[model samples]
Target: MRLTRTILAFALLAAVAPIALAQSQVEITSDVFVMNEAARQAEFEGNVMVVHPNVTVWAPKVVATYGEGGTTDIRTFEASGGNVRLKTADQDATGERAVFTPGDQLLRLTGNVKVTNASGTVDASELVVNLETNVSTFTSTGGGRVTGIFTSQ
Candidate 1:
């Protein structure tokens, strides 16, 4: 149970950490909002969006779990089943699925992952962003090469 809670904390924090480290209120909206208090989970379907001061996430579906019986404290979230987008003021990432865990300090993006910023764009089959160290690693193993277009320093 403690591990689950820790994972939840990591996962949800990973999603927003790229934007900033400070804690802020996050707002999520969708066509359907279903909460299961018994399970401490929520399901948002159809045009699901998680919005913050400097960051925004959009997907067709998002599954979130809360911690410590707190409805507002989302410990973890997974977005899937479409072009899942994580956008900040300058950077943008899109993938088929996105999973974040801040406690573990890992952010995973898979399936046609593309990350773009003013500097350039990177394409990979999978992307792992280390939230703790602010490092990113991209890989592709399915005969698809990791491609990137880099601009000036």
Candidate 2:
């Protein structure tokens, strides 16, 4: 019975270990941080930076709106200030403004958006990324055209 219990305990631990490690929390830092509980919003300004497991964001200002669950259940994140940038393990992107909707797993960047990766670089007036599907779409408005420079690697 003792040996059987030991084996079962090890199996349980192995099963739960991955889940614990996967729940990496996001961290944000900036020169100023403000929370408005009444509005269910939090704002970071002056060289705001956010670090997550998959990506990092840098901007002059970022505002996060939470659902009823508060900060843990963020609904939307908006970043603005002429030079918003995001960096991932494989790519980097910059734009004048960026908005992320967690529920839809969508990120939208507008105003002179540029994305660069090992494969190529693309420039557009707007960019939409579907985080869940790992797909990105770019578009140019006001009678402009999307441009890209790709290099074979």
The candidate that achieves the highest TM-score relative to the unseen native structure:
2
* lDDT (C-alpha) at residue 103 in model 2: 76
> Positional deviation of 31 in candidate 1, in angstroms?
0.2
Worst 10 residues of 1 by lDDT: 12-21
Model 2 Cα lDDT, one tens digit per residue, 36-111: 6678677789998877777788999988777786455667788899999989899999999999887787889999
Enumerate clash totals for all models, in the order shown. Answer: 7, 0
Q: Write the per-residue lDDT of candidate 1 for residues 1-153, one digit (tens) a residue.
A: 867665654455344433334567667778986656578777779998888887789999988766784644656668898689999898999999988764576778899999999999999999998877989999997798999999998
Query: What C-alpha lDDT values do all the predictions have?
Result: 0.77, 0.77
- Model 1 residue 48 lDDT score: 88
TM-score of every candidate:
0.80, 0.82
Candidate 1 residue pairs in backbone clash: 8-75, 10-101, 10-102, 10-103, 11-100, 11-101, 11-102
True lDDT of residue 56, candidate 1: 89
